[model samples]
Each structure stands twice: as structure tokens, then as C-alpha cells.
Target chain A: MSFKVSEDVAVCGGRLLKLSHFSQVIGTIMNVNVYLPKQYYSQTDNKVIPAVYYLSGLTCSPQNASEKAFWPFQADKYGFAVVFPDTSPRGGDVPGDPEGSWDFGVGAGFYVNATQKPYDKHYQMYDYIHKELPTSLDEYFSNGSRLDFVDNVAITGHSMGGFGALAGFLKNYDANRYKSCSAFAPIVNPIKVPWGRKAFGGYLGADEEAWKGYDPSELVKKVSNRGNDRILIHQGTKDPFLESNLKPELLLEASKGTSWEGKIDLKLVDGFDHSYYFVSSFVPEHAAFHAKNLGLI
Target chain B: MSFKVSEDVAVCGGRLLKLSHFSQVIGTIMNVNVYLPKQYYSQTDNKVIPAVYYLSGLTCSPQNASEKAFWPFQADKYGFAVVFPDTSPRGGDVPGDPEGSWDFGVGAGFYVNATQKPYDKHYQMYDYIHKELPTSLDEYFSNGSRLDFVDNVAITGHSMGGFGALAGFLKNYDANRYKSCSAFAPIVNPIKVPWGRKAFGGYLGADEEAWKGYDPSELVKKVSNRGNDRILIHQGTKDPFLESNLKPELLLEASKGTSWEGKIDLKLVDGFDHSYYFVSSFVPEHAAFHAKNLGLI
Candidate 1:
């Protein structure tokens, strides 16, 4: 339940704490990087700093987004801590893609709880990311009562992690798990997309009904909007995976006539691609969106 | 004299143009990345955008700083373009380190023209970076006269590139090549350090006099300061190579009684390492310094 600090780096006006801890849910050590804004260190008025969780895409560790996403600056500006979690569990005994492909094994857990064969033992990333990770972080950093990891928090991600954010947010919509949600070039209709179909088939088995539970397109139709809550999303027009693996329009189409209609603000940015260059470019806007939703404004 | 565009990426209200060109000075193809800020595109006011050449550290290419330095946002903020130059000439028939080390060859050009045998063929980085590259860029982009790659420019770098910026700026001090200069964890006294001695000896062939021509510590005493001009620098206290390789204080010590005394602003930032994390953290400050010097602020 306790995290071991591997490196505490000074970035921006705060510290980026690279932490590793044994996960009871995933049955493996999970790595997460947390950036505590300067407000956390010098809070004479004892203000409770909120947190924003940023999930990464395939073939990325906690280090990629921590280094290139340019979140530390915005984190400092909004007085919020940023959490960056690993894409999947790694190391010994972890079963990788059977075909030895990058999209299926090792780096690509797709943030799903596997119900299939060999994967069932360790690939419980859905539970790990949404449930245990947050609880553990809340317990670890809430000692001083200066950091709020659970209550006053927002969520955002890129690519595959975008789908994870949409799915996770909708699944826990009734409970209000995340105050706000946003994604950069996210895989929205995972059930319809090739990447999501493969991941869902492998992790949740061929049961399409089980896949529906994690599909954002389906979730938008099922989950009722509480108030005037909106989900911000930015998709690149030049993204290569647009038509094939990430059909974001399916979510908008599915949300038609549902409570989420017109509530999913999808902005297609011109000339942007599916890279950290794209993610970091619009991070300022997303940070501002999350900041307002988290009441930091 | 012309550059080939490989990847033109849209990032942070601008485009990052990944370019490769045949260098007349180095006798090989050199890769570079240039970022044109938003002002270049929507220029109804006809502003002449200045350029800032950022040299990378050892074991780095133009891509390292282009991807992680977080310069595009600042460039967009100040309406100045950024040019990221490769550390060394690479590829087909280009010889690397004899010892197969990262610090001596390939990515570690040290930004000096080599007078030695094998290295002399393609290691003319000093002339390439400070001379031919700028002249070629000016010719290529000055068709509209909206981009000032030559007349109004600044230079800044990290580690080895930091040393390069200082050496290049001082050697061309009388010529007034760069309007402003700054560095992040630079190798100021390279002639005295192990990395410097190895690079200088290998490239300049053991001639201490030839090495002094590219040493900032030596050039600081030789080059008279023009007016109240200053060089901004940020060195992380926790940088691993501070003591043995990057002794920044030596430059200040060398400038003690010279015309450049107190003109070198070396800031010692606490708890920061020698990673892009540290560079990106201080880039805004360096950008502002260069902006003021380039008359962008």
C-alpha cells in the first residue's frame, strides 16, 4: 500500500516524484509519476491542492508523458498536482503479446481488466488505474491534508488512454469519480475500432457484451448526464489512425438523442498529428478546462 | 544551399520543420529542425521574425531539444523562430568514436572545427554552425524578407551545446553575430574538464593554442565586452557532471579581471538535474532573456 520513491525530481516550480509500489490489484509493481505544484510546498493558508490524472497511449511508460507532455508548467499555473500512470504492468512473468507485437503485449494493456487465459493473472489495469491507484495515492499524499487525490480531481489522456479516460469516466459517472474529463486523439468507439476490438477480444474475451461495458460509445448512450457537465476532446485532422483505429465520430454519433448529445465537445484541430507534439500543444487548453472544472479558478 | 523537408509537424500554434541539407563546410548531410511561430503564418502586420539557434548537449540530435525543450510555446509567445541544429555530422561513411563512446564522437561534436585526420573530413561543425548554416538559411528563407535568420539572431544551448554557444558567441563577439546568448548547464571551461580535454585534444590534435580558440574560459579574457551585454546561464546544482565535466564557475573565474567580468549571469538552480526536465524548466527564462536581446520583448 506504500509507494517507494525512486526519484524526486525538481521540475517547473515543484517536484516530480517518480514512485513505484507493489499493486495488490495487478499483482505486480506499478510505476507512477506525480508532480506536486509549488502551492503544495508553500501553502501558508493551507489550501487543498487538487490532482489531474493523465493516462498515456500504447508503448509508453510513466516517463514519456512526464517528460514531454509539458504538464509541469500548467500544473504550477493551476496549482494542481499531475499524476502519470504506466500503460501496463511490466517485468518478470508478465505475459506479452502472443504474436510479439507492440500493440498487444508488454506496453499495451489498453487499461482493461483481462478475463481471458494467461492474461487474467496480471492484466487488471482497469482496476489498477481507476480503483487501487487513486486510493493508494490518496492515502499516501493526503497525510498533510494539502493534496487531494480523490475528491477534487480531473482526468485526461492521449490516444488509447483517451478511450480509457472516456470509458472510466462514464462507468463511474453516477458516482462522480472525476470532476472533468478530456482526451487528445482518443480511441472513442473501441468496440468498433480495430485496436480496441483486438484489445477487448483479448482482454475481455469474445463476449461483445462484456466489451460494451468499457466502450465509450455505448456508455454515452447508457450514462445520463448529471448537470451541464461537458467532456472536452481534441482530435488531430492529420492523425494517421483517424479512420482506422480511432473513429471519434462514432461516440458523437452514439451520443445522438442521448443525454450526452452536444455535451462531448470534440474539436478537430488542423494539421496536428498523433504524437506528444500534438498532446503538448493543446495541454494548455485542457489544463485550463480541468482547472475550471476542479474549481481552482 | 537548399534544405529538404522531411517532416513538417504542427505544434504549439506553429510548424516544426524537420530538415536535412548538404553542408558545404562539413562535407556531409546535416539534420536540423526549425520552428516557425504563429506570427509567421498570420502576419497581417508584416513582422520580421528573428531566429534563436539552440545547440543540443552531448549524446543528442536536433530532435532531442525539438521534442523536449518546450521552445515552440515560448517562440509563439515572443514571435521568434527557433532553430535546432544537430550536434555532429552523422550517417553514411561518417566515422564515430574510435573507443565507441558517446561523449567523444557521433553526437558529441563539441561545436568545433576538427583539424585532426579522420574527424577533419566531416567534423567542421564550428564553420558549419556559425557560418554556412546561417548564410544558407538566410538565403533560403529571406525571399520574403520576413524572416531574419542572419541579422537578428540569438544563440543558446545545453551542456556541450552550451559550451558551443559560449565559444561561438565569444569568438564572434567583435563581429556581433548573435544578439544575445544563454545556456542551460553548459560546459563553460571545456579546456580544463575531462570531456573538454578529450574532445579538444581529439579534434584539435593536442594543440593547446588551437583548443583555446574554442574555449569560453580563454575567450572571455580575450574578447572585450561591448557595452553592458550579458550572457544568461542556468546550472542545476544537482547535475551529475557539474564537478568533473561542466565546471561553470571556471568561466566566471576566468572573467574575474577581464572586460567580461560580472557580465556572465550564471544562476545556480537548486535540486535540478541535467535532463530536459531542467532545461525545459529554465527555457522560459532563457527565452525571455533572448527575446529582450533580440528586441522581441
Candidate 2:
């Protein structure tokens, strides 16, 4: 579980460490970027920095959010580290969409453990991201206990990765895996969307029942949110895929009459599109939300 | 003199207007991005917002700085609009480097008005940027005098664009064209550097004397700085082009015994490279400097 430091860049008041490590779950080399905020390097304070994992949208490597999400400044402001993991396994022999489409394969891992052929080999991202990657990072950075990866963490993402954050948070809701959760233009109901249907049909096969295990809308009905715990979400009104692929209202509708009712903060911001421009504008608010939940405030 | 709005993107309490217009000086269509800060749209405030022009480095369209510089937040904070102009005239029959190099052609206009063959047809960036572009923008947005693109403005850039900012600011020092001037790892002595020599030779021809007209190092000796004016600069020690092409020390040496002596704030930051990562890291400091000079503090 040793990680190779490919590049350590100084950004804002901290360092963004580009790391690559071998994941036994996926049997491949995965890349991830972690931002160690200014507080982590403070010589006077021996505080353990909590991490906020940020998952990127489709067609994004760890670099997209690291470069444009404007997270480093917020992380420094809130005294928390940020972890940016790749969307999917890349490089040789890793199969992509059979038709050469960009929406699937390669950059579209969908963050699910594949149960189908060809993809089942390396598309074990559900395990790689949630189960193995965090533990591995916790073990690697255990030198001085200056950074915490396992406990006292928050999760957030954009678009496809946003859906992944919601599903993952809901699946591990009872265990309280994440202290806070938020999404930017996320596909809340994956089973009902075209992008989600295609990714799920390919990775989880024809069994729609199996797809429910990873769908946020379905999981919202089964999972109960602890009292006073709220999930914050921001959706752009001008997003092209709002009606067709990202029906965020479905998640709220599914939570009605359940223990999670009225706990989802769905903010429909006007005039914003589904670009990093939209993701970054709302990042400051999300950072503050996560910071408060993580007890940094 | 008319600019067509291509995309109006909502970001950080304002809008990023992607505009294209025909340039009478360059004899071609050009692209520029302008961010109108939140104060511009405020109903209660009638303040005429000042503009800060951010010239981009080599191989960059106006989009590079608009997307990555993290300037919107700072602009909103200081109530200043940001103007991002293209490096050169692009598309159509406009010529690039004869050898197809990225550093000289297309994106590398060096912000000069070419006096040589072929390039003279379209490489009129000096006139376009420092003169025509600003006047045209001022005219285009003169509805209620909400934004002051001219008269009250500052200038700053990175790498080749950094050189452009310094040269432009110095050449027009007597007129006080730009109220404040700053740069991020700019080529200070273009006549003495490889990138500068190649660009000057291609644009201005064999007469080395003509190059001095656009060289900041030479201009610093000729131009007298106003009593209280100072130029801010931040250079990364780890920039790959620091030694070979970006000799920032040359400008300091040239300023010795001149009116500009001890007025150029040259900050050498350690461990930063020549990417947007480096540029964005120091943007807040530069923003504050320009904000103070522009009287927005």
C-alpha cells in the first residue's frame, strides 16, 4: 500500500501532493491528489487535520478538481485537508466503452464494483474508493498522526462523482462514515437517468434490483439520517441535463414520509451552468458546511 | 467597435462575458473575456467599477486565465472588473510561427505591433491591447458608465504576458495609462532573453534598437516613475524558464539610479513552478496590491 509521490506542488498556503498507489481491490495503479492545508505544516500546532474528499465529474482525473475547484483556498481557510481521487482506472488494457464513446469506460467508472465481464477486472471502484483507498491513505500518513483520513471526514463531489458521494454516504449512513455530505449538480436518482442507466446497465448488468444497491434515490428510502444531520446539494437551473439526467427532486420525493424527510438541502441556484464555474461558485458554502460539521468551526 | 457576447457565464457574484469583436488595429476578429463584479449589478451603489486587465502567457487563449486564475473571487472582493484579452489574432489566414513553434506563433503575439512582413498584417497586439482594445471595450460598455475600462485601470500578467504587462506599463509610464502594474514571473529584459530575442526579431526585424521600444528593462531607464507609484512582481524560484528566458534581475539592474529605484517590489517565492498553480497562488496578494492602488480598498 505504499504510495509514490509523483509531484508535490505549492498552491495557496499549502502543498498539493500528487500520489499514485497500487490498489489490491482493483489490481491497478490508481492516482489521487491530496492537498495538505497550511494548518498541516504549522510548527506551533500539533493539530490532526481532518480530510474532506472531493470526487470529480465525468471525464475528469484528479487534476481537474485540484486545479479548478478552488478548494485549496477553502481548505486552508477551514484548516482541513482535501483528497481528490481519479474518476476511473486508466492506462493499458483497461477496457473502455465498446463504441468509443466518452460517457462510459475509462473516465466514467461510475464508482461501482462491476459485476459484468471485461469491466469486472478493473472497475472495482466502489471498493477501491470507499473501502481500500481511505484505509491505505490512513496507513501511509500515519507517521505523526498529523492527518486523519479514516475518521472525522466529509465527502462532496460534482455530477457523476456527486451521485457517487450521495450513494456512498447513504450506503454507509448507519455507520456514520461521513460527518457531512454535499453535491454540486449530482445525479440524485441514478436508476432513472440515462447516464446512470447506461453506466449501471453496463456495470451492474440487466438486474435493476442490483442497481438499487448503489442508487441514491433508492438508498434514501432505506437509510435513516441521524437527527439534525442534513445533506446539502446545489443544482444549477441552467444545467443542460437537469430534467433528463439529474432529477434532484426525485431524491427529495423518495425521502418523503421517511426518517430522512426535509433533511436534504436542495438549492437551485439561478443562471449557473453545469461547468466547473458552477461547481466552484458554491464550493465556499459547501466548505463552510463541511467545516462546521467536522467541528473545525 | 461592437462586441458579440458569445457566452455569459455566472460565477462568484458576477458574470463572465465571453465576447468576440473585430479589431481595426489588428485587422482581424479577436476574442476577450470580461468579468463584471457584483458591484456592477448592485441597485444601491452607483460606483463606477474600475477594471484590472490580466494578460495571459504563451499558448493561451483568453479562456486560460478566465478559467484558472481564480480572479472572480478577488474581483468581487475588490469590486473591480477583470479584462482578459487574447494573446494574438487567431483563426482564418492569420499566420503562426514559420516553424510551427508554440512560443512564437498564434498564442505568442508577445503583445507587440509587428513591423515585419507577413506578421505585420495581423500581429498588431501592442496597439490593440494598450490602445484600441481598451477604448473599444469602454465604448461597448458605456451604457450608464457602470464600468470604467479606461482612465481608471491596472495591468498584470504571467510569463510572456508578464513581459507584456511590464513593457506596456513602462512605455506608457509618462501618460499613466495603467494606474497599477504587477507581474507573475515576467520576462523583464526581453532584448536579452531567448524567448524575447526570437519574438522581437520576428516582430520587429533585424534592428536591435527597435526592440528597446518594447523592452521593459530599457524602458525603465528611459521612463521616470511617479513619486509614489510602485510596481509589484512575484517570481517563482523553481520556474523552469527563470534562468534561460525570464531573467527578472536584469530589470532591477537596469532600474539602478533611475526614478524607479527601490520602487519595484520583486518578491521571489520559493518552491513554486511556472504553471497556473504558481500564478493562482499569488493572485490574492497581487489583487490586494492592485486593489489598494486602484483606490478600491
Candidate 3:
């Protein structure tokens, strides 16, 4: 699929390219933002630049993280590109939550391949984000450029997007699709959370086994983590969703006897919330972690 | 007389306290956001933390710069507090532009004390920002603290607010009110520009003499500069308003042959715009400049 350049605004030593492309997987026009670090423009070396895909929380577009997450500075600091993918396929015809609640409808795709009726027509976001989008971007930018959008990439997200990152990373762990993975106040065990249950029930036709494939708590048990691989996670204590929506402790408990035990670096920060303020506050640490894993440091 | 706390958000190594207070100067409850850096909470030393007052441009509230400017990191890095003040007094009863244009109404006070009818009753932003707001904050945080909101302070802003900073800095030059002054895409020669002419005509009632009092280009000639005092400025060459609304060159030209000659550090950044992305891109440099002037360096 071809891409259209909507806006290329200069931000923090580089440019933030806002692009909209026709996604073959989702059968809709998907919006995504890519920040190319200053190194890309000033590069004398012929090295392929790795990418970090950031999935946003509920009620978010690619613009939220692109504007507030402050990732451009971090991307410029260590030579890597950042990709901000939209939460879901949004249009008038696209089926949303019938109740008009923010948690269930559009902007809350939960990053899953839908099997349910009307949603299945345009809600193939899991394939759109993790597979089709990256391949298309690689093809779009492959004009004598060595920007690797497929391999040597890191993944991170906030809340629902955080759940997406973990599930995607673990599902592709054997193939080593993502070199590094991190989350900011993510819903680690989506299978046990209300947000996950509703989304899974709506999109996957209430199939509990289908839900397990996208749940990090369940996926961690099935996917064997190779030796010395760590997944970084930060959870805010003051986050209102900690008790009912995002019980991060469940993921740790599920990983107790597995190879993923002690490999998940879950840091509980004090007095922070589930906002972009929290996501940006710790982006430097996450960037450095990804930089190390991507061989940039 | 008393401040009301609305939302206290944790951001970057600090907390953003969103406050509203009834102001005698403006005759309304004014909104302000103050960012108390991490050092404010974790201080063992009795060091007086300096403050930086950031004035927003037209049609912006306290939230615009607070969210997009990315100043919290630099404030924490250099141990200073940042204050974001609303552009103008806004309410339904308060008078706005009869034409309902965004340029000269509600959000466009131009940081001047209004003398005209229908606006003078509530649009005293000049006194509200520079004098009353600081005094109120100092009184609010005067419990065994060393946060200096009055004396050891820096001033900076973008576009309209940039002009405000320059005008305020120059008007109080003899008193040495601010330790440092900087701007991003400011309208320097307000007397000659259309936006300034309209604002001045509306706020000051057709008095060109009164307009010169707030014009930085005119103030440069009237106010004798002290030795070794420099004003730092960054203007985006690609700013859409550079030709019509913001003629930064006139300020430098007005400073020629005066005591302020060669003291203005005006940098024309390449490919930048009149957006917060441009402001944040250069915040590190401005922060360092202010930090040095505030004696933090």
C-alpha cells in the first residue's frame, strides 16, 4: 500500500512526519507518525536506523504520544526512529461501542484481530500495526535508504497500548521480532481486567482461548523467554486504574514458575498517574534501555 | 485573595500545581499553573529556587505551554520553578471583540494594562502577571521556604507573550526586576505591526504615545541599558507571522547606536515554525541561559 505525507513538522533536532496510508489488513486508511532523528539527516555512516513503536492508551490517536510523550528528544539522543500508531481504525461506518463509552469503542481497538461481525470489516489493528504497517513503511522508505522497520525494532506503549506491546513482543519472542519491550502504566494482565474482558468479548466472540493469545499474563507462560532477555515496565502508584483496571501484580504472579520470572523489570513509581506526564517522565530511562538492547549504546 | 487548587499533576521530576486565584488587578479569578521542580521537594540545602514566568501567545490558556513547552525537565535539571500564566481575563460577562475575532479579543490581551472602556474593568494582565501573581505566589509558599518568586526570576514567552516579556523586561529595566529575559518568535516592533496596532488601538484607545510605552523597539531607545545585560531571542525563519506580525529585525535596528547595541542575542533558527514544537526544541538552550543568569550555573 502507498502512503501519503500529511504533515512534516520540525520537532527536536529532526522532523515528525505525519503519514496516512491505506492499510490492506484493516481495509481502511490508517494514520501513523514517524519521527526521524537528526542523525538520519546528518548521517555519514551507512548504518540502518532501528525503530521504536509506541502504542498509546485508550481514547488516543497517534497525535497524543507524538505531541506529549517527548520521545523525539530521546530518539535524537540515541540514533533511532520512533513510530506512533493509531489506537484503532476510526470512521463513521466502523462499528464502535454501542453504548458510546470511551473504553469499548473506537480509539480502543485493544490491538486485536476482530472475529466479531461489523468490527471484523475494519478492526484488524493487530495485523495492521505489528505486520502490515511496518512492511508498508519499509517499502515506502526503501529508496536507497537503510532504515530497518521490520527487524531490529523495539516496542513500547501506555495502558491498552502497553498490553499490545507485551502481547506482540511475547508472541514474536521466538522469531525475535522486537529487540526490546517496555511499558508505562500498562494493563499487564488484560485477560483478567475489565478493559480486556470487554474488548476480548466484543472482538473475539467471547472465545477465552482467543483472548489468551493477546494476554501477556497468559502469553508469558506459553512463550519461552530466552536467557538474559528483560522486559522493562513502569507502573505509577497514584494511577487511578491500578486497583480495578490495571493490576500489574497479576502478570508477575503468572510469571512465578516460568522462564520469564524475575526477567520483567516492573518498577512501581510513587505519586505518578496514568497520564502522558508519567509516560514522558520516564521516557529517557526507557529510551536508554531500548538503545542498549538495539546496540545503539 | 485566596488561591484555589484545581489539579495537581506529577510531571517529569516535579508536580504541576494548577491554581486559580481572585485577582484585584484583573477583577476576576485568574488561572495559573506552577511547576515545582523535584528539587523543591527533595531539598536538604537552604537554596532559594528562582522562578521563570512564561507568558503564552494569543488564544492560549495556561495549559498550552505547560503541556507542550517541555520545560519541566529543564526546571528540574537546573532546580527552578516555572509559572504559566493565562493570556487574558476570559468570561461570558467580560467584554470581548465585538467582531468575534481571535486576534484582539478574549485570549489576546497582549499583556498590557487596558485603559479603554469595556476592557479596562477586567483586562489588567500587565499588572496581574508581573506584579500581583508573583506576590500572591510568594505569599502562598512562604512557609519555611526559599522559593523566590519576586526578585530572582527570569522572563520568557512565545509570539505575543514574547513581546510581553521584552516589553516587561525593558519597562522594569531600571529596577532590575528580572534576572534574565528571552523570547521565541516575538513581535518586537509592535507599533509598526498590524496585530500590535490593532491591540494597542483597542486596549489603549488610539493613543500612539501610550503604544510606544509598551513597544520594545521604542523602549530600547528610551531605556538606557545597564552594562553587560543581554537579551536572548530565537526567531524561526519559517514562521508564517515573521513578515507581518513579528518583525524581529526592527528591535535590533532600534537598538543600534544605543547603550543596548550588541547586547541582544537574536538567533534566527532554520526551518523552525511558530509552534510549541519549535519552542520546546530550543528550551534546553534558553533554560541554560536563564540558569546561568539566575546564578544556578
| Candidate DockQ scores, in order | 0.93, 0.86, 0.83
lDDT of 2 at A288: 100
lDDT of 3 at A284: 98
Kindly list the per-residue Cα lDDT of model 1 for residues A87-120, writing each as its tens digit: 9999999999988888886889998899998999
TM-scores for every predicted model: 0.99, 0.99, 0.99
- Ranked by DockQ, top first: 1, 2, 3
Ten residues in sequence with the least summed lDDT for candidate 3 chain B: B39-48
**Model 2: per-residue lDDT, tens digit, B1-297?**
999999999998999999999999998899999999989888898888999999999999999888889999999999999999999999898999999999997999999999998999999999999999999999999977689998999999999999999999988889989999999999999899899999999999999999999999999899987797999999988899999999888889999999998999999998888999999999999999999999999
**Candidate maximizing DockQ:** 1
DockQ, 0 to 1 scale, candidate 2: 0.86
lDDT of each: 0.93, 0.93, 0.92
Give the alpha carbon lDDT tens digit for every residue of A203-283 in model 2: 999999999999999998898777879999999999998999998999999999988889999999999999998998999
Docking class of 3: high
RMSD of each: 1.0, 0.9, 1.0
- Per-chain TM-score of chain A in candidate 2 equals 0.99
Candidate 3 lDDT tens digits, A28-72: 788999998988888586678999999999999999888888999
- Looking only at chain B, model 1 earns a TM-score of 0.99
- Comparison by DockQ, 2 against 3, better one: 2
Off by over 4 Å in 3: none
Give candidate 1 misplaced runs (Cα > 4 Å).
Answer: A43-45
